[model samples]
Target chain A: MNIIVCVSQVPDTTTKIAVGADGKTIEKNGVKFILNPYDEYAIEEGLQLREKFGGTVTALTVGNDSSKDILRTALAMGADKAVLISDSGNSDTFGIAHSIAEYAKTVVPDLIILGRQSIDYDSFAMASMVGELLSLPSISMVSSWTINGSSITAERDIEGGKEVIEASLPCVISAQKGLNNPRYPKLPDIMKAKSKPIDAVTGASVPARVTTVSMELPQTQRRGIILNDSEHDITELVRLLHEDAKVI
Target chain B: MKIIVLLEPSGNSIKRSSLESITAARALGATSIHGFMYGGDANSAQIAGEYGLSDIAHTPATEYSSTAAATSLAQFAKSESASAIIVAANAAGKEIAPRVAVKLEAGYIPDCVGLALVNGLIQGTRPVYAGKARIAVSATTAMSVYALRPNVFTARKAENATSVNVRTFTPQLSESDTRVKVTNVIRNEGKLDVLEADIIVSGGRGLKGPENFHLVENLADKLSAAVGASRAVVDAGWRPHGEQVGQTGKTVSPNMYVACGISGAVQHLAGMSSSKVIVAINKDKEAPIFKVADYGIVGDVFDVLPVLSQKIGAVTGK
Candidate 1:
């Protein structure tokens, strides 16, 4: 069996996002980047599949120069190979999916795995789109998964409950949290992974069907009103909710 | 331009978020708003029509997979000459919209919180970096598809209800399109899902152990709100994964979010920061949850929870 995990490099959750001078993208100066948190599960799941089923795991990412660092991290996490697919120069989720599909066409791994959605974009679109582009079944936001021969069963989150889905091999699976606890790269493995050369593929560019016009920060809130004040009381809190906030 | 909304039902009626999508369409200057659903009949159409729907397309409800559903919906939208397709940012809508957009080779936008029409072109303000920042995007194609974030826009009802026009649609779905099949949908009995609950009372590790969750649940019972848990508590197995509220957990935008004993981790804040009104109660004064909270009470949960619950019960008479 062969497995491929798609990952993305995003701003660290703690990094404060500032609107760039262009007003369309994040200001990169003094920003820290990390592998998308959810993608860690995807990378770990890939390693687990390889360990259990005896297969090669390949980590793939899309972005510019900053993406290589994440690919190296995947290498440290025991992914056998790493590929960096250029962003295909489009902001369209479809374009991103197609670009990844282009690489999948070459590898044709038995399974394609990814986090449910990247924290940065949060479209939750790529895994399904890749499934469509490749004509493979995709089970999304899966918490638990099992395989028997070629049959795959995935347990995923629905609104009120969980659903069990069945699909054959050669399908797509999007990893949700609780799938597995990812392993931190040991110092030795990290050093070794740093030396491992990563393959770079360029210009998978599908034209973006949608384009960004501008961006703005969410309006800052006034300092929180601490209810520990003498003017604030529990009864007043309830009344404020009813008459002032009107949320009740 | 003809605007279409892909409707997802919350129990018997249209999901509140889908109604917001309809309101989004109307805000885009749509006079004739059409609703598209995969199943149900004239009865469902009645509910949708109440929310500004002039016409409804009822496709034959089959056990179609996500791929089949997306294929059928995209084809239907094309046949009807839909200029814009909007859906709620729910599970099905997020899964289906990109497929439709890719299939139609149209513009795709998801998780849009606000929409505007600039010179007859549709544009939206969507959060990126997990609500850390928001950007405005516009469609460069003839047909654009969007998934609207829930609770961002108030769902306003359209005036002057028109006669409902219901159309039955037979999709050309083949077996090859649905190889992935959902065998069972097992809903937790008698529990209100956090996503659908208007009021949520969440607890954190401050409760110490599973035995003390009763405090949170007891308060929730008084307020008639669903119970939620912070990631720390969920990770410790003190609660089921379903009740977890954070980046890894269900994102909730309830009218009122009461955080008890929760120190707002960024991961947790990513999920609930969009809530309309946030109230945080914690022993630690420096807990990050206080940042986004509309009201903060720096008091010990054990000391304050029962009293607040009792006081609120007295006020609400529940």
Candidate 2:
């Protein structure tokens, strides 16, 4: 089996986001960036698949020089190789998917995996986008999957239930949370991965079909009312929920 | 401009989210709104007419395949000369819309919270950084695809009875296009999923242990709400991952969100800050959940939950 896992870096979820000077992006000066949490599961799943099928797992990403950090983490987690397609354009989901699909064509991997969605954009569109670009079968939000010969069976969540899906090899899958517990990189592997060579290629200059015109913080109109848990307070809260909030 | 709305069938009727997509499409002031679906009869989908849909198209398929559906939907939109396509941001929609956009060479915007027409061009407002920030976006492509977030747009019914023109659409599809298909569906019977629930009662570490989750469940049952959990309790194996609500879990915007014993981490807030009303109960008065909550009660869950449950039951007559 030949597997390719796509990964990316995102601002830590806890970071306080602010509008950038450009007014269309987030401020990066004081924010902390980390490997996207969902991608860790994708990398781990790819490594597990390689272990069971006896093939190589390659980690791929599209970003600038800083994205190499995530590929290093993937290497630490047992990926056989890392590739970075350098691009500076942001807010372009289609452009990024095209870049990854272009890279996957060269390797001709049996399986391609990614996180269900990136935390920053939260579009949840990459797997199907890349699958369409490559003309391959794709599944998203896969929580559990089993491989039998060339056929893959997976379970994914929907609006109120789950669906058991069947697909063939040479497919795309986007990992959802609870898929698996990702393994932590050890100190020795971390040291070895730091020196691993990363193949760099220039990303294709695909123009963004979607563009952000402005950005702002979400305005809060929540009425902050605090009370104690006394019997009187409980009654009052219920009353407010019925009359003021009108939710109950 | 002609707009196409992708519809999903739920047993007999169209899914509420898809109806909301029709509502979103209507907001664009399009010349016409057409409803399309992957596998279902046109008769059962006639209910979409009440939601401002001018026409409905059904293409029957035995199984579910995102690629095949995208291919067919994109082709239908092209044949109709649609300027935009609207779909609900459900699991299947998230998977299919982008592929349709790729095939049509259209710009796709996912999880939009608001939509407007500015100078006769449709623009969208979507949340990024997990609802911490909002951005206004537009399509550079002539054709655009927008996936409206579930539960945000209200599905309004037209005052007058409107007739729908229903038709069966046949598109050219190949074997390779539908290589992936849904073989079986597993339903979590009798449980309200947090993602679609209007009211959710979530428990946290302050509930002490799995044994104490009944308090939360009882409260949820009395209030007719879904049971949810914080990451701490979920990681501690006290609750299932499906019920977890946080950044890494599920994002919800229920009408009322009740957080019990949760400290309201930034990631947790990110998942649910769009909720219409928030209520928090915690022993530590300074827990972060109180800040965003519409109403809060400062007390231990053990002491407060049962009383709250009984009072709610009394009011709801449950």
Candidate 3:
């Protein structure tokens, strides 16, 4: 089994985001970047597949030089190799998808896995686009799975419920959270990853169908109006909801 | 411009979120709103018309299938020359929107909180960096697809009469297109899920144990609200992942969100800060949940939950 896992670098979930002067991006001066939370699941799943099926797991990502941090992290997490499609375009979802599909053509792996969505763009488009480009079956937001021969049985969330699905191999699986607990890299592996060579390739230049016009902060919530344990506060709260907020 | 809105069926009527999508499409300068139902009854068509749909199209769809439906919607949009395709940012929509974008070779923008038409282009503003900032995006295509978040846009009265023309279509499909089928669906019998619920009562680690979640469930039952859990509780195995509400969990924009003993982590807030009214009950006065709550009661969950549930029950006569 040749398993390929796609990952992305994003602002740490805890970072305080600020709009850049350019108005089309975020200020990254003090913000720390980490591997996308969902993509960690995909990388871990790839390693597990390699362990069970006795083949190589390759970690792939697209970004500029700083993205190497995440690729090294993937290497530390037991991936056999790390490939970075270096591009500074901050390309739209379709452009990224085309770039990944361009690289996928070279490897022709048995399985391709990625995050359900990137936290930054969160467009949730790449895996499906690659699947469509390759004419392969694709499943998104998979939380759990079991590989059986060439057929993979997966379970995913669908609105109010969970659905069990089965699809053949040579498919794209977009990992959702709670699939598995990703293992932390041991000190030795972390040290080894620092020495591992990263393969770099130029990303395909596909024009973005969606262009960023600008960015701004969302309306901040005001300080809450805290109510005490008094019955009057509760009664007033109910009245305010009905008369003022109108959300009751 | 012609805008196609995908309306999903719920019971006999269309999903309220789909109506909100239509409402959103209308705001995008749509001259004619085309309602497309994956599968539904006559009642859905009437509901669509009430929500500003000029015409309705019904297509046969398998349970939880997107491939065939996406292929057909692409054909419809092409034939109708739709300027944009709007869909509810719900499970079915998210699952199918990308596929539709791929098939139609159009731009796909998911989780838009706002949209508009400018210079004959569809523009969208979506929350990014976990709701801290919004990205303004303009689709540089003749046709684009978008998924609208629920509970944000208000539905307006349709200018036309209640009656509208409805059409049906059956698209040809190959076995490979629909190789993945939904074999089984697992959910809380008869209860609403957090994503689709108007009211949600969520518990956190402050509840102490899994058994105490009964306090939340009891109140949720009384108020006809869905039961939700914070990441801490869900990670601790106090609740299932399906009930988790946070950045890595689920994004909800419910009418009312009740936080019980939750400290309101940034990740959790990202999932539900869009709720219309927030009510937080926590013993700690410094709990972050209080910062965003529209109404906050600083009290012990063990003492306050029972009283709150009783009060709501009395009001609801449940």
Best by lDDT: 2
DockQ of 2: 0.85
Instruction: Identify the runs in model 1 with alpha carbons over 4 angstroms from their true place.
Output: A88-90, A221-223, A229-232
lDDT tens per residue, model 3, A106-157: 9998999999988876677777788877777888899889999999888888
Error of 1 at B165 (Å): 2.4
For candidate 1, report its TM-score.
0.95
| Candidate 1 residue pairs in clash (backbone atoms < 3 Å) | A88-A205
Candidate RMSDs in order: 2.0, 1.2, 2.0
Name the best candidate (by TM-score): 2
**Candidate 3 wrong stretches, greater than 4 Å:** A221-223, B39-44, B62-64, B170-175
Worst 10 residues of 3 chain B by lDDT: B60-69
lDDT of 3 by residue, B67-159 (tens): 666777878888788888998777678777888887787888888888877777788889888787888787778889998887787777668
Docking class of 2: high
Candidate 1 chain A has its poorest 10 consecutive residues by lDDT at A228-237
Candidate 1 lDDT over B48-108, as tens digits, reads 6666677877776646467777887888888889899998888778778888888888888
lDDT head-to-head 1 vs 2, winner: 2
Tell me how far the alpha carbon of residue A27 in candidate 2 is from the true structure, in angstroms, after superposition: 1.1
